[model samples]
Target: MVAPDERIGPAQTGALRLRLSLFYAGFFAFLGVQQPFWPVWLASHGLGATEIGVILALSIGIKMFSAPLAAHGADRSGQRRRSILVLVAGSLAAFCLFALTNGFWPILLISVLFYALWPPVMSLTESLTIMAVQRASLDYGRTRLWGSTSFIVVALLSGQVLVWLPPSAILWLSLACVAATAAACLFLPDIRTERSPLHRGLPIVQALRIRALSLSLAACGLIQGSHAVYYAFGTLHWQAKGYSENVIGVLWAEGVLAEIVLFAYGGRVTRHLGSVGLITLAGIAAVVRWLGTGLTDSLAAVVVLQALHAFSFGAAHLGAMACIGETVPASLSATAQSLYSGLVWGAGLGLMLLASGWLYHGLGGSAYLAMAAVALAGTFVALRLSALTPRLPQP
Candidate 1:
């Protein structure tokens, strides 16, 4: 097995793992508040549904191009940590501008700026964490579970907070959390090592030529993008269907709770099922989840379906990370990670969210049927991914 070396003692590795976990936990808790609530806030500020969609889509869309650019700069300079810190500082400024703006154009411009700075953080953090795991030989699952746990906690609590506070409070809370992330970044150890001149630019053509890799990326994108309907309008849909905000919170929390469990046991799971198997299973789960969500209006049914997010999102993501860690060279790790984030989360999700807005407005509850179809396509691609490459021993 091609496993990370365990040369560093457990004591040292354990401490670093704790630090990495804390950083991501705090960071994503901020996102947990933002993603679900930001659009609601925009609507509250008198942006129509179409306008709100445009702003959100624009915010995420720019990441497709910007993330690779950021990764290229980091790789070329061999200053990943410095690059992250600079972007975080830039993100803080963008948020400040957002706070001061009310006009559509200004808000849109700030959103683009904010997202441009935002995309690099996750990719760089993943690169740094993977490097740390390799250096200290720590279990990635154990180290990463804290993030999932934190997200659930913040998401549940923020739901109640929204009931008591104005929607704008979400923005302020997000800013505070980002500030904390910046502080955490200051403490993060600089982990950049030798640079490869050969890995300087985006390997667009080369990566696209890898049939298995390309298929996996495409499948993952579609499967993950299938969440656009739910992510953008799930709460509003439930609200319209007469579910209380608290119940909506519980539904969302259920999904993250499942994700936490998945991350907790991720290492063992990956050890038993290879990355391709995991991703394929996730695609299958997504098909079921989206279909079930579309077919039922029952709160219990929705909650049950949301729990499948463990496989649909958690397992699929772990599988993708494992693939990148195993197949992509260390020098190209940031770029590969960024490509995943940019292509899947940025472009794919952005486009799906836009389509979802139209569908939700036009077809109402049945919009999820489209999401299910998307998941089915992803499932087919995932099955194909298994055949494209030889199975490797699990980590």
Candidate 2:
């Protein structure tokens, strides 16, 4: 396959990067609003901690099936951008139901519907973005950093807005961001890659047979999934400790800012440490981060812990992307990305969210200790993965 630059000039390559940056900005802006405050919106409706946890867990768990199924269809059809447009449009429709529903059951149904079409958007986009990287020589981290930038901006603004507005305002803000993302998706490049003809049988089945890919994904999932408690209850925990929404927002944005810094230099970092090293570093950072988060509520200590987001999230994410780029074939890209999103962030995070509910209910902030344990286990897996796949070659 010839590089896209051979056919398309530098101007078009710049345009491709621009479109991707805008899309990331829009999508993650929505996430910025949703991730930090969605629980607040749930609490406004009189739901208990356990109920909120159940709702969050179920939404993500459904993606274990939904994400892979969506990516499979996209791969088979060779229309990933079209599939993404449809999914985001559907997600907008599903989220609108939140305004009509109030109770747990009604909200749960809508959450499942929304997420089934939502989370896969990221996986599909990653597939497209990576294809762009391979074909056009675009930098993945620089392209993705726009998302982190938008997240930081939106989160900081939302924090200030919440100081004046009620929790209900979160739903409306999130809706607007989702609509923006849908609009942005229309401009995404429909880059396609040639698949390996040797591949046969189910894509997921074929993918799982690769020990390096499977183990690395599993290890990454455990590490990322360890964020379940923080995702679900970090805001609530801080509020209970007497911090204001403004402070909570700053804390959230601070973490992503750290992520932004890492992504900005990701190419250099990835070259130095490689994918295995990145995941190993992420596991180590997770242990320190969650342990510190659990052991103290002091703003000073938490601020320091939040800085580790660079390694815990950004590094692990870069590692996973690099691993997929090296280990998976072009034909199975979407399937592999979807499996990472579905199995790792989906099922792995879902189960952790469930356990987090019980742990937080009984032990409060100390629940982070459980997450630390999970991260430590993931670190061991990463070490084993490194031992097994010393150097995975690109297909």
Candidate 3:
């Protein structure tokens, strides 16, 4: 492994991890509130599944382009932290407009503003976290676990809170989390890009050209993108099935709780299996998980399936991050991170959302069948990834 630390001293490396961890915790707390319950809030507006799908799809699609552009700037200027601060502030301001509108189109417009600004920040932050990991010999999973912790907390608590409050409260609570994220971003390292000739010579397209890198991104896209229906309609579907909001929240928490433990322990496990091996496991588990989710409304069955989040999401993500960290050099770090985020979460999720709307309406619980198919395809891609020769680092 190449340990490129951007010339920071050993002492600063430890603090950098803590700062990055806090940023993850705060940002995911924001996600905790939004991801599970935002649909409920939109439903409160009387938007049907098709409309909500379009709104969510557009949000996902926009990030495909927006994150890369922002990340390119971060990579070029070597100001990842500063760029994130601006994004956080801009997203907060955009969310503020949500309160001023109640109609479908108006809220959708504000979402456009909000999604464009917020989704890109995480890829930029991931670039920072991965760089620190390479230099300091830290674990990406451990640092990322904090975000999962906050996610569970907010999911459980907000579910309880929503029982007493209107769905509208999600906006204010989400704002508070973003504000905290902004505060954390201020503490992050302001490391600049090294003026090395190797770094200077690397172009963004080169990362895409490498067979391993592109395959890794494709495998991740299929695996991670498979969550589209769950992210968009899991709560609504459960609610329609008569599960209480609190139970719905617990269901969401259960999945991420599995993911949290995976992050805590994935370091040694992934080290042995390597990124490609872990991704293969992730794809296989995703197929099983979604297959079960599509087949049953049995709460016990559903809860058990959610446990596969450890493999389906946590393992897949851990492997993908490792792949990006190991394959892409420091010069293209942010750009590569954005590419992963855009393609996997951005385009993949976006396209799935477009389909999930129609599927959920017609097939109900069986909508997850579509996702299972996506995961199955990703498994085949992972097999291809395993066959590629690893690229050696160029200094």
Candidate 4:
């Protein structure tokens, strides 16, 4: 475990905070460009909806296996930062392979490699930031907010850039952003935590035996993965409804902006509401959000529901991270984080996305109703999780 003092601190932790914030900002900026535009770019290359879903699913699915491998490497070597840099470099190379070819099989192969190299970066980075906060007395939200802000900037600007340039530019933009992330990685301080010789790495079986974590992951995964319908098809839906590219950008930015605000106040919210309550709230919001998204066609109604992203995504994410951070040991932090990301975010999400693609083809807008049902199921899990686990002490 990190020393108690290392976990909580005053707002200003000096230069380390600034450096870490910049690193996250650059990394998330890359994601902002990729997440919202990558599908659109794939479409331009002649991939159908199902194919697009498959490709995206494949990319994410690889993370299920890859994240654990990366975490194991980091844990065994006790070189978190170095492992992250190596993976980032590997991802860059894989993406470069994507740029060189438009062939389906080649791109698919590259997609797997690209995603395989990608998952560890975020998990390890979070572990690093948490360590820094523990050691230096810094605010996680204040430091992490830079990434959200950078994402907003990129989302908005990339919209305008896409308007003036071809869709092909999306790849270039992604490459540029990742390059910037690499530069930022160079500035992070190398801080090692107290290693436990008794370190029994993440007992996957034992952790799974903890019914709350397992159930929470399942519920959260389905609820969150339900967004695959939105993530994969929302922009297309909006476009089919006659919205412009710029309007789509605004909509995307609005959700992320709400996410930013949630993160900024996350610590306080966690303190006040606790993880179970917050996650329950998020699950409830997702039910309403997805159902409203399915029931309404009005632009105003759509915007209102998108704003609910603050709770559905932002709050739920905060709850999960806090839960994982608290329950997992320092030695197994990376592995646990990866497990959450891999099993829930990667596997659960991938399957749902694939299903959503088929549903979109068969049912059009009504497919989101299925997504709402998934969210409702997740709400039950969240409530159950609250009942099962003991709340950890707050900072």
Candidate 5:
């Protein structure tokens, strides 16, 4: 029998793709529930806006340290699946602690443990998926779109469920999702790359020396981080506007539905636009989307703006993955992926979450205008990035 880490043939490729797709479905189902409603659960505990902000920001911020450490170890060990299993198992254990807590401080402590372990799973999975894309000639977007599909389904279902159940029901729903993720991890392919050489100092530090990669990371960070206000409070904002939970769920699902379309045609889009072009497009879309969101609460207008999530999120994400896969060596792939997630989602978004609480509390829906400015800054960075890396990655 061939080694698990060896190059997969056609027979194995089919099975590998199936297993990876299942993992994405299970994992993102958890996010579908948590992303839109977790704030409601926190609010139900009587924590004010500032307290919720601190909890969310601190949880994300901790990833800056924890993600790098976990990925670095994964890189050194060259055991992607084992590392993922361990992380997901720990995440499940930490998330369960929510059942035992009620107050801000106690919940905050558990959130630190949960968020720390939960996000690195995405980074590592990205590394594995990209490897599959290269070796098996799989379409990265199509395979990954399974996650978005599951996300939308679960979001819609949970929305209906929340209509009947109390906010605390979110806790139970999320627990089941987390357990499903851990169970799914057990079936993931063990497609390990060669261990990264540690004698060369930190891989991420070395990665910083590549000008194109550095600029790409910065550009992606700003663009993705611009979603802070929306992610943290979009549901709550709509709730205050008198929209039902079901409608709010539909709005969230609508955005990801557009994202799914983009991912389904990812390869063709990448070929036409390239990585730099995609990021440029994303920045532009974000500027318009946030501005429109800030200006109007009309259902029609909100629906139109939400569609821009395809470019702002889906394109930016594909562009970043292409940049990493093209620029980084296989040995350093896990480290590079982790660095992107840690810095962009972890630190960049964490800071924005901190500011978003203040922004939302003070300005309400108008807080989206601030996010528009953030996207505008990212557009400038991406434009400059286009000049530095004239020949961009097409993956």
Candidate 6:
């Protein structure tokens, strides 16, 4: 893969957007199935809660290093789509190993390899989407909304499917998504970005010298990282509080539904408020969301408050993307995306998740107080980011 000297025409852009959308839809559709239900499958295999938690934590922790390594290779090769295909294939093979083994150690070893390759796909794909967004003058939120939509669809549908099928069927369902994503990659436009002399083929450390890039990444990561407690224990907490399984599921679905609405109108939201303001809104909403979550036992209130996930996750992410678009150079795009994924989502959230288990054990719903504080700090960081905007000039 080599970077082109000039941007392509719209006819190509339109086609690439559809293919990219399909790729995201297929990939995240699998995530929708995997995240919530994989544990159920693990439990069905007789893995204890401790074993399951360790496996999940290990899988997430591995990505802090693995994703960045994978992104570095993709950037060096300038072949993001090709990198994704390899990861999908490698992960699928690992999943097969998981299927053949029921023992704890075998499953753990295979899971490590599987997760190391798989998590990088999104960071790498985001880089591709960013490049395409730059070349095509597209809307990132609108395009990414398709992935969220697919996530919701698969999550709901797979729940029903799981009721009818055996637990072991999850691996096959995951494989189908991997295969579909690989096929979609085949249709991706064969495009690469030319190296910028400004970047001077420098390392990621040098890329971080840009204050806006680093600050924005940190802020967005914290905002995203704040979701750790909610993701890990939200269902169990609700269940213990006497909410039925179906109701707890709706609470989860409500958040995603709100996120979809936010993304669907994301362009309008960004245009009305601007990027910095949008991120600030996300931070403030997160504060309220988590605090309310900690304090409330009112089901009606939780339902309404769950809508705040839209601002918390969606707007904070769009703000980060906007910052990267305006501040980071195209040459450093892949590095920046991976940094957000590896550091923010992978390492930062992984640590928070570990803490959440302890907190949930000790304080139950009051565990959310810590998450609220986390979001509050992130809110302040986003405000700082708003004040420090710097654009990267084309070389």
**Cα lDDT of model 5 by residue, 1-395, tens digit:** 22334666777777878888989999899988987789899999888988986886776788788878888888887887889999999999999999999988998888888988988897898888887777776678888999999998998789889999999999999999999989988988778777777788787776777776788888888888889999878988889888897788778878999999999999889878888899999999999999999888699898899999999999999988888877877777788888888888887787788788899999999999999999989889989988878765453
Q: Give the per-residue Cα lDDT of candidate 2 at 149.
A: 96
Worst 10 residues of 5 by lDDT: 1-10
Candidate 1: segments with Cα more than 4 A from true spot = 1-8, 40-48, 162-168, 199-210, 239-242, 297-299
Predicted candidate 6, C-alpha RMSD: 2.5
TM-score: the better of candidates 3 and 6: 6
* Residue 155 of model 3, lDDT score: 71
Highest TM-score model number = 6
TM-score of each: 0.90, 0.89, 0.87, 0.88, 0.90, 0.93
Q: How many residue pairs clash in each candidate?
A: 0, 0, 0, 2, 0, 2
Query: What TM-score would you give candidate 2 relative to the actual structure?
Result: 0.89
When summed lDDT is taken over every stretch of 10 residues in candidate 3, the lowest stretch is: 194-203
Cα deviation in Å at residue 86, candidate 1? 1.4
lDDT of 2 by residue, 25-81 (tens): 999999889877899999999889989878867767888898889878776766688
Q: How far in Å is the alpha carbon of 8 misplaced in model 1?
A: 4.3
**Residue-level lDDT tens digits of model 3 in 31-74:** 88987788888888888887886886787788888887887777
Listed per candidate, the RMSD to the true structure in angstroms reads 3.2, 3.1, 3.7, 3.1, 2.7, 2.5
Worst 10 residues of 6 by lDDT: 386-395
For 158-233, candidate 1 gives per-residue lDDT tens digits of 8878899998898888888888888877766566745646644354444455566677788889999999999878
| TM-score: the better of candidates 1 and 4 | 1
Best-to-worst order by lDDT is 2, 5, 3, 6, 1, 4
**Pairwise lDDT winner, candidates 3 and 4:** 3
Residue-by-residue lDDT tens digits, candidate 6, 1-395: 32554565677767777878888898888888889788988888889999998998888888888887887776666667778778877877777787688868888888888889888878877877777767776667788888999999998899889888998888778778877777776776655754534445554765688787787677777778788889988888898789998898888889998998998887677767766777788889998999999999899999999999999999988877776666776666777787888888888788889888898899999998888888888888877876675322321
